[model samples]
Target: MVILLNCAHHLSQRLQTTFVNYGEATMYSLETCPSPWLRSHSVWGRYTVSFLLIITQLGFCSVYFMFMADNLQQIVEEVHVTSNTCQPRKFLVLTPILDIRIYMLTILPFLIMLVFIRNLKVLSVFSTMANITTLGSMILIFEYIIQDIPDPSNLPLMANWKTFLLFFGTAIFTFEGVGMVLPLKNQMKNPQHFPLVLYVGMSLVIFLYSCLGILGYMKFGSDTQASITLNLPNCWLYQSVKLMYSVGIFFTYALQFHVPAEIIIPFAVSQVSQPSSSPAWTWSSP
Candidate 1:
């Protein structure tokens, strides 16, 4: 995002107006560029990009929801199975059954509350918690992963083209914080340091992700599940890592939810002729 940051900074200085988020930046950039060719369809450019970003962010939130549900469901089921007890089916209203679908239903209320949070400052606390939980889970899993040594020759160096595409897609998905750059920079206390912050944060993420992939593969060879968490030992300690990761993914959902809400809600609010009376835009006088 160094390039994006530099361009945004240049725009901010020249225009003397802060770019709120990607939509606004794209809109303003297209509208005000020197070339008439670029300025021809600024409104369409903004709307098209906004729709694409909305889909992207919402897709991320959907993934997070399923991820948390799947991990939590597995953890719960494992515990119940070890105890030789059936997973109670009637655990609704009071609680949810040990099923991924039910876990999502159970999670929806808290998820709604989390997304309703309008302040980025407050939302950053959840983001920080997510970072902590994710790192903690990774550390815990890595501890288990490094224990079993396997021969390097046991694993294949390359996969078939189809599976290689799967790996490529997953790697790209894992590295998807680029879409948040403009909004995050807008929320920063000092936006000038965003490039440095981006570099450090992304470098750390790449290092951790690479370590997990390489080390986990070296240890497990080809006998891995969709998630590395699933390949962990079926002990209480390892099971707790699943809970930690579910919590991390839950926390991450809010950040992804924020980007789409910023774009869609503003446009929705603007569509109303009398937005002043809308409860979403303001509160009743207290």
Candidate 2:
């Protein structure tokens, strides 16, 4: 991650073309970079990058759906405690829902409406609130876990290769914000400092995630639920954490949807009405 992050920054600096999207960055990095050896398959680079990003962004949105659903459903459903900690379920549930899938269904309409928002001001407001609530939720989660943690001495060193692959994949998804690197750099007044900002910000993110993962594992051991919020106490404060988390992820759905929208929507619109000129994307090249 560190190597690729710096590589992209330097590569962007060498390319004279301004990139507004990941596809543009990919195309230039392949076709027009200063080093000829680094450039190849320029024609297809934009398409490949767009396809991969579409899949990635869609997967992220789907995860957001499931994340909100899982956390909110735990808060809504009636508690059904199991004696087996290994199969722990239901900490604090308020209402009854037959299936977890139903919780995702309830979130669908709002998510659909969320992506249609083109106004920058509204998105800023929503993102700010989401950031605030997300921070609060993480604080609450940390507080909840630190109360009476168990011994980690008995914990296994590592899981099998399969679970390790799952960990690797999840970590990759966590860092998928790298897709916005070129656009972020492009918007900078002093783009040279952008790399510094990226490095510092991502370093902090890595540190925080490391702390959270270690603490969560130490706190729950083998019985950890899919979400740490679900393991929280069945109280008003903890329940609020669940709601805040859902709201945060809920608003985040729009940001994730934005990337694919820019790539796909224009082409779809162009197909509806034929213009003499080519579609707006323009091969993501200069």
Candidate 3:
């Protein structure tokens, strides 16, 4: 929360400075900044930010793939475990398709297609839907956590330095919304209200992250998977929740991919001859 507020304050300052210096408020993406480093005018800065953004987006995509695959695997495995008549089959049957890698591949093309949608305006609707589904998933997760309260004595209050480092990294990654702040603020109909929006939105984000992190660790202890959704009970409702959350993450992948795609695609297009041959290339062409 503090980090969010700090970022918001910094962004607010930057926006104000830009308005004062330029004599008008205008949308400014990271690459449009006056600073050579931020705007990527320098070779080092351009490559560094480009690599980091692409790597980060790829990391997010891989995580989403794993998340959906794991949940789907769990759903299928649980179904078989609970059902008496279900038998393991060979020779490339429907059961074989339940494999995690299969699930990952099944959803991969859809994600690729989604990334083709370069327009933020069109993607915003899906982003809103993703937020809604994510919220619903969180509520369901909270219900599950509260229903099975763990004894506090069994949970550790502190961890070793190594574990603390892990926690720190995780927390940083969880709250890494600073990069999105400027673009989001720029897109606002009334950019002046962005500070208020940031405060309210990030407050909720912090609250949710804190509640989920603390309660999830408390509930699952050492048995927790990378995602709390994997630890959910083997029930139809919980299974549905996992599916819903996967869909949300799937939608979110486009948003994450948008950043690096926008950064790299234009540059790539400008280098290529006859970029207008491809629709995506034309759309991204400088």
Candidate 4:
């Protein structure tokens, strides 16, 4: 961005200088030059470009889920004493799909509307609620999974007190909404609405998670995979649900580092566009 900005600035200056040198001979102004043309061309292009991104992600997700489902029975058959739960691969992968579904269908669309949303305060409240609820869901899931380990097979993995502590401690990965919290916080227009959103979100999260966990526990008991896939006895439902979940997750996690990249890209490009600065490190936004 820095490089682009510098190039824009330099080109603007050069155009003005050229016009002055030409002295009334040139019909075109700097605004009509190639730099401005490019700027105009690309200014609203991100919105359109983002559409293609969603399509590509969805396609990849479909293929991935299909491949996984085809091998799922074989994968399940391979499980032995060492493999107590379906969560090692399936759950880890599926939860992200759930997260992505919430983000794209719910959060992302809502956020995009933030630009033109009339009810800034209300929307902020909603966003805060969403984040808090998301966090609550994470916490509840962690608690349930930790406590509801029905299979004695996993007990050895948590044999020692120190090891037990490590297992629960590392469970933070299940609740990893820290990456999203700050952005939600900053976007809130009414600070007072935050607490309300958090409370509501948490309550919803707890309720949904408890219900889901209970249903899950009841359905599979000892056979419970960390994810829905292993718990699903019906092959068709397993494939369908897994497909949907994987697609959603692929979108959300794939952009986990987007916030930091957003900050870095502009500056890198700006520096590159300058005469004395190093070349910019711009790449296609993934």
Candidate 5:
């Protein structure tokens, strides 16, 4: 009888232990299954993608600056010499289309593509970069206006075709990256505000460029280069201004190259300037 009792007691304890073990294992499996895969992929995949993007952006900007700087410098010197004495060269370039103005056309196609991007935050960062370039150009232009135009010039106006052309270029500068706006806008946390941001941002850009263009043109006149960098005055001032403008151009290219890189490889989207947590919006469900 005692033997039978002992056997029965042992069976009960064994059953209890098995139930507890199975319960704990089930909970552990559930908690770990979904998260481990996600964490691992994010840590490894995200960094890899971002690093590749940075490399490509730097390469593109470096190439552009290397090839274009000399012609631009010559144009600036000529404009400055002519503005004070000679009749400004007959609208130097034959067609307005020849310069960065062509980039304005890129805005439409960029918007169409932006609609399909899945990440909003990445778009915001890109938009911010474009905004900075435009804003920087405007600031350069404004400095020219403040310095060059004199006599009843406390208020600046769009006085001539040259003025109009300069302003048009300013618009081009800001809107040049229009292609990236839509995608970046779509990725924003509150996309409705995107247009507002665009208007406010671009208006500020216009003001800056208009001022700079007027100043640079008045100071250098018709001899100004396609870029504002050439119009810089000689002396210590020119060196500092040159460095500042050069930095702006470099930054513009960084964002510009990033746009294509982000499009080609979604992973690269994270490489654009931003905090570590920024989401990369590469794809969208059609």
Candidate 6:
């Protein structure tokens, strides 16, 4: 756990330094242009960042989708099958499709629509709500962890080499916000304070990730799910936690999508026709 925490901290600081150096070099372009530093880069640099952003955000979306689907499925199974025997065997309209698939299909349109909303002001409410939900979920998770502390004797100090890749991948996925650091710094009212903001924000994030990862592993041992939320007990409170965190993840998708969208959409538009006087052209003009 200590090693993981240290790794997270160092990785975050390294990302911050990279972003700061990049931003310092391209501050003027980032402030004036829609695509920011990406547009100013060589073809290879632009494509590399674009590919990483697209892949990372897509991975994040998949994680969120699975997180929502798995928890909701568990909650439904608990309520309908184990507790409320009187309820219908299946609650979904698409009986042929799996419940998780049904949920994903149902929510996908709204997520797609959200991607088109370019205005950050319009997304601020959802972002605020997401922050709240995330906080609530963390509190509930900590409560559960403390309530049932596990014996340390049985737990491994380090996972075997076979599982090391899983640990490494999970850590990378958790800290993949590096792609957004430049964009976020560009948006700040006082850009000079971005270092402080990054430091404080990432410190909190590292602390939370460490606590949840360690406590969750301690409690569940080897039986943990891909998401700690899915391992939560089948109760109303924890069910609410799942749903709330899902909402947070749902809202967060748009913000993550924004980075890649800005990078790719401009290039796509440039290929269609000569840049026009329209807002879309102006926003994404090469």
Clashing residue pairs in all predictions, respectively, total 0, 3, 0, 15, 16, 0
Give the CA lDDT, 0 to 100, for residue 113 in model 4.
Answer: 44
Q: After superposition, how far is residue 169 of candidate 6 from its true place, in Å?
A: 1.4
| lDDT by residue for model 3 (1-286), tens | 3454344445458766421111011223444567766555444444565577667666766777788777777666666443333122121223544567887787788888998887667778898999899889888889888765778687777765777777766766674445455556556677668778877987888888888888888887877666676677655677678878888888877777776676667678778776456555454311
* Candidate closest to the true structure, highest TM-score: 1
Please give the CA lDDT of all the candidate structures: 0.75, 0.71, 0.65, 0.41, 0.46, 0.66
Please, what is the TM-score per model?
A: 0.87, 0.79, 0.74, 0.39, 0.41, 0.75
Model 2 quality (TM-score): 0.79
Model 5 C-alpha lDDT versus the unseen true structure: 0.46
lDDT of 1 by residue, 1-286 (tens): 5765776777787778766556656777888889798798787877888898888778778878888877767766656434333221222232335556788898899999888877777778998999899889888888877775678786898766778877876876774566778878877779888888888988888888888888888887777666887777666676778899899888877777877887777677667677566665642101
Q: In model 6, how large is the Cα lDDT of residue 119?
A: 64
**Which parts of model 3 have CA positions greater than 4 angstroms off?**
1-43, 82-99, 160-165, 275-286
lDDT of 2 by residue, 44-87 (tens): 77788899988988888788888888876766663454232333
List where candidate 2 sits over 4 angstroms from the true fold: 1-17, 32-40, 79-96, 119-122, 274-286
For model 4, where is the 10-residue window of minimal lDDT?
A: 18-27
Residue 187 in candidate 3, Cα distance off native in Å: 1.9
TM-score of 3: 0.74
The local distance difference test score of model 3 is: 0.65
Q: Write the per-residue lDDT of candidate 5 for residues 190-275, one digit (tens) a residue.
A: 74476568778678766765666566656655456766654544333433445454445534553455444454554455466656
Give candidate 1's error at residue 244 in angstroms: 0.2
Ranking by lDDT: 1, 2, 6, 3, 5, 4
RMSD of 6: 8.3
Q: How many backbone clashes does candidate 6 have?
A: 0
